[model samples]
Target: MNNPYNLVRKYDIMLKDFQTISTSFLVKQLPTATLFVDMKLRVVYASDKLISLFCDEKVNFVGQSLFTIFPELDSKWETVLKECLTGKSSPMGVQSFTDAEGKEKFYEWSNASWYDSDENIIGAIIQINDISLAIESDVALDKANILLKQQSELSKIGIWEYDLQKKTVYWCAMTKTIHEVALDYVPDIDKAIDFYKKGHSRNAISMAVFEATDKGRPWSLKLQIVTAKGNEKWVLAAGKPIFEKGKIARIMGTFQDINEEVVAEIKTKDNAKLLKTLIDHLPLNVFIKDRDSKKILVNKSECDYLGVANANELIGKTDFDVYPFETAKLSRDEDLQILETLKPILGKESISVKKDGSETVFLSSKIPLLDEDGHATGIVGISLDISDLKQKEQELRNLINVTSLQNKKLINFAHIVSHNLRSHSANFSMLLDFLVHEKDEEEKVKIVNMLTQASDNLLETLENLNEVVTLSTNTQAKKEKVNLHTKISEIQQNLSEIIQNNKLKIINKVSQNIDIRIVPAYLDSILMNFITNGVKYKHPDREPQLEFSTEVIKDYTVLSISDNGIGIDLEKYGSKLFGMYKTFHTNKDSRGIGLYITKNQVEAMHGKIEVESELGEGTKFKVFFK
Candidate 1:
């Protein structure tokens, strides 16, 4: 395929130049590092110093996920980063982190939306400058302390120090303000320790201070403290011990109010828990699994359906443990396929089995769970049980079939009335003409006898037609379970003399207990039509062979009757196979009404018939009944 946008041609030239210029420019910039990201959250270029500063390895960064290198970034960072690439500039931010060696580090980062020569938005350029040493320099600390002394009224920050040698405490004005105390109040080290809250917060502060003073360790902790007003406040208490000649002299620290942020964070976590609780109580089956197919979470409905007491019993387990081997394999493969394609599978029909051994049909959907870097990490699947819906669907189909069968019978009835009556009336007129033309008494008597026989034949045809009309009108018949083999046995016996005279062989393969939902009379009539047709159409060259078999399908039972007899030319007469007064054979016994009435009776009981035949060989009729 040819490239539509001609991007391939452009890339063919630009990529070679990019590797040279971009790599060289990044290397020359050295410790002032920068990273270029494509729209896909992948690093298109990274400076050597950027990798060394954060990862400390000669690891390749190009073509790797930006989040893979910086996993601490969350959805908020992703949104801002993508916004930058979409032509919005992000705010300048400074992040404080710790290095692998446990040294404090800070980085200042800013984003710029970059574009290609054609004015197309390519990606975002993020420049990162290491500023830890600059921020921590003694000159800067001194300058900051001086500015703090000059200001004296910033309410969010406070400074404090402890003198180990003198066993004294000093609190700045902001510190006293934070404690809600008088500026002239005097305090010692022990009195200052009483300000922390009574239990965990006080103990944590004490431990942190001890480590700072005894081991020259700097500590940053978030804890609650009690003010002089007797109200609790959250504070960030950070301290660094000052050592002189390998002996501890003093410890200095800062405090900032963090109570509001802490409260908001707690509420966010509680909201997440509440959302999970809501999902667990929903009426569908829902579950989440990891990339390895281990269960991460399951809703209440899923747990109940799987026969597990609760999600606790399922966590960390695979489907192989909770389901049959084949079902588990099928389910796991679907989950893996969704993850691999990063696409959702919606409304897929599936089957499940209940604890009581009944089967249920349902619809399921699975979605890929992705990380901030847009990598699929797991899958979430939901299944809604549609067994009741399926049952209703089958009922509707059965009703439609019954209605259609009734309509077919109505049309055939109209044809029988018009065509059969005309034929018999014509025969009556021809017999009268013969009686009028006769000149001898013997011939006239013979004509009268022929007319009597013709009238009797017409009456017989009318009786058969009446039987068909009654079959179509009767709807109150009960559908009892009829054993198919027993029915065929009774039919064969009724035709025993005919079968024996023809030297016929009967093979009954139907199960003895196989039952079908059919009216008793309809069953007898349907079997009789096919059985007699098989015998009547037997080949002159061979003895007749009949075979009967049954099969159970999803919604019905099927009965098949096979015979080695003269077969029907379905191509020639298929459209009128069950029409009124239509016959396909030259035999005198083919009244043409047998198959038409047979089809009506079959359908009157909510059954159907299909025929397959080769002209010279054999015929097989398959009947379906509920």
Candidate 2:
């Protein structure tokens, strides 16, 4: 086949006319870049625009192979040129390559295989149009689509589309996954419509579609739907009509699954309602104020206390609107302090002035309400009416002061009695000595017996006074971690003689690592008192057995002393078990002060003591310590 350039050369006889026509009409009028290639893919002709953009200098490019002129096109140039030379037409498609300046350029090119007069293939004409802007726009669009898909997946939302004209529905992959259906499921209009819940959802969507198509209106609504797996869900559906010549042609819309968010919103509303009900039923007056200190919400108790007819009347009102200026100012200041500090101010006293000019004192606890940012946005408070309790507390304080004065007088009187008893006992002993020296045998013997009984009575009174004084003193015991196993072992060794004499059996189950914070001396005294008491009150009919064990409860340790001996009737002596001078058994050694002292020691160390007993069954004393 002859090259098209050769034919054009034959037209060189009219080259000047052709050049004038090409420059005036063809070259100047073409908006696109144009080039002509011979069968060998050599550039035979190129527009002035193409020459200026690609070649720069026209003489450097003419008669050059197209690939040589633009070597960067080596990737796709051979295949495209071969197709064109063979008379096969290809659709216009985008091609990109870098220029001499290293800047990228994109073009959509279309080529036609030119033929000679004999209908044989010759050279080809190529038209090029710059599509860089369009390409960039398409790239941005693709990126946006990818980002949108990612965001939808992250938020657990899925989108769907439907075309009314084509009667076809399309679902994104996420949408199918949300409905628990297969990706290959081809949705029909009827099947898609049936997914909507029966009553309001179906009716609303039907109405929306009808209106969008019939009236060319747009609609957006939240509706419920049942998935293929029998799970209920919430969806946000929107639709708009596509018009052709002012007539509705198609309706398109998106469906988004918003089940989780919708359900959470509903639950939040329900919880708020329940909380309001609880606050209203509370005995204390509960109120909340906005940043401006205006009442935003108040419980029924507050409304009734302030003598307001309804809660609505309390809105936008401050305490000043309902109380005296002094009381209102005090309340407002407390609230302001709470807000400024962003902390709770508890047990502050305030007065509530009634509409009738009567006032009542209240113990109020106010706290700042913070937003998600940790900034205080308002205040919430509960005011407890404490007027009656306040009056009783004042009366008790007065009585205590009077009682303290009486106690001082009693201590002085007891000291005088002690002095008198000592002096009398001395005089009686001198009198008994005088009687013994008198040599009156019968009288001397009777006098000596009376002196002995008098001495015993005096000693008993002194011991009782000492016990009373110990009970009245407030002295805290020193605290340290005491290992239970070691302590028990030491106490058992100390009491080994008594244990052997009584043929007693002792069971120890205290763990070695079981340590508790307590006064070591006080613990030893407490344990001795418990063990001796058990032996002293042992059942006459059976051998004595005692169990010593320790366990931990919450933040404290419980050391239990259990005895299978004579047990007191807890129903009769429970309250007096730890009271001074209270004794259950009639044992001669029952001082009754042991339990009282043990209880005080435990309490001094911030601990507690309790007892459980059944007559003739056993007695257990549990001492709890830090």
Candidate 3:
């Protein structure tokens, strides 16, 4: 549209002026090192900064090839210059080189072909930047990342990032391992969420990620994951939101495997439940106390007995706090004894004071509670109330004492009466002797037989009475520690004749270590009586087979004698089996006094006897002695 020559010339002049100004301003004010290169790759025009960096001298380097100025980059410089001058784009990463003085420096270079208004490539314009510190920082960061990766592998920790805007997920190698996925596996947001379990784990992770992305909230949670191989695991996850321009950009976090720890916690909870159930249902009144004597646990029965509202009220309170002074003092003393001994203290007498201020006696036992190192850390105790039984026993003892005193007086009177009767009988005998000489022989014979029968009856009654009195008296005062095996052997020797006559087979399983406190004479008599009875009651079809053994009961030794012979009907004669003159069998020697005397001797020595029998199977008698 500009056809006039004068106007065209003016426009051309104006365009030239503008180009010169633009180039001069760009060379002086550009951030990077700007340079112009010729066809030979020589520096044609360079900014003052570029000149200062490459050449210290002020002389122009217009005709010098770049390789000549920097010979260290000879071939690389020629190739890059040629590509740019041929109208190609060239980009390079930071590289280092030595200058003329051999000082090392780093730089980043970008080159593009410069064109004239005719659109023809003329020369190259190159942009250079000093990046030594930036390159060094990048190298350091790479090394730190390598170290972090090694640590994550060793600790089984995993890192991950989720870009909210792109809906993409990126995982580290350790993160893949935590998810039990292959190294080459590509995970997206949805696929990553699916790795979590289908229920709570998936729902929780989704919610946390959503909140982090939408509300910029950070989250930490423990969740469960189901692996590709159908294995379940526990993982601790923590994440923080990344923000750009006041909006969520990404979410990054770590994951740690905690399956072992979580499983252990679950097992501990289950075991605690089982222990609580056992404590609640136990029959005895049980309680647990801390090392400071403060009650930590009290069972239902214990709380009811104390008239407490609940077990919680009893916690942090000691026996002294809730009980009377006298009762608490005795209990404290017993607990101290247990601590001193580091052993269980059993059968301690204690009296509990109730809320109503009533006293109840109990037999209490305490055992030391041990800690992980097997040291006594606390105490566990059980109490059995025996107040009512104790009262009844006291009443029975008073009645028995009175009856014994009256019986003693009656025995003295009987002795006097017997003496009188003997004297009268002697006188009658003398008179009869005189009459016999002068009277009929048949009448004298009758009187002599009658007197003989009366004397025999009186002597037998006196012997029975003396045996009863002796059995009723206490014999434990003479008790001493004796080896049960030795005593049993001696008894066997004494009864050897009877054993042989009856062809009895005796099985003795008694150990020599079994020692018991009992009267020696009583032990001998008891064993002898049991052996005689076994032989006497032998069935006609089988020879007597006796088994003798001893075992330690709670606080005593029990001597068990069992026989494989005709057994008694316990259902019919159970109560009166040991009664005086109670005979079960009809025999010439069935006096039944043997069992009666055995029972009396055992009770006198503070022992008890129990029997178990069937009609024809066999019989076993257990004699418990302290």
After the best TM-score superposition of candidate 3, give how far the Cα of residue 294 lies from its true spot, in angstroms. Answer: 2.3
User: What lDDT does the true structure give each of the candidates?
Assistant: 0.84, 0.81, 0.82
The backbone clash count of each candidate, in order, is 0, 0, 0
Ranking by lDDT: 1, 3, 2
Candidate 3: C-alpha lDDT? 0.82
Q: Best candidate, lDDT-wise?
A: 1
Q: Give one digit per residue, the lDDT tens place, for model 3 in 544-613.
A: 9999998878876889999987899998999879865679887677776788778878877767899999
Off by over 4 Å in 2: 1-29, 37-44, 55-60, 63-65, 75-94, 98-103, 112-124, 151-221, 239-251, 320-328, 353-357, 391-626
Instruction: Quote each prediction's TM-score.
Output: 0.55, 0.52, 0.42
lDDT of 1 at 35: 81
lDDT of 2 by residue, 310-333 (tens): 999999999888877887887788
Q: Residue 468 CA error for candidate 1 (Å)? A: 2.7
Residue ranges of candidate 3 with Cα displaced over 4 Å: 1-155, 329-344, 372-375, 388-626
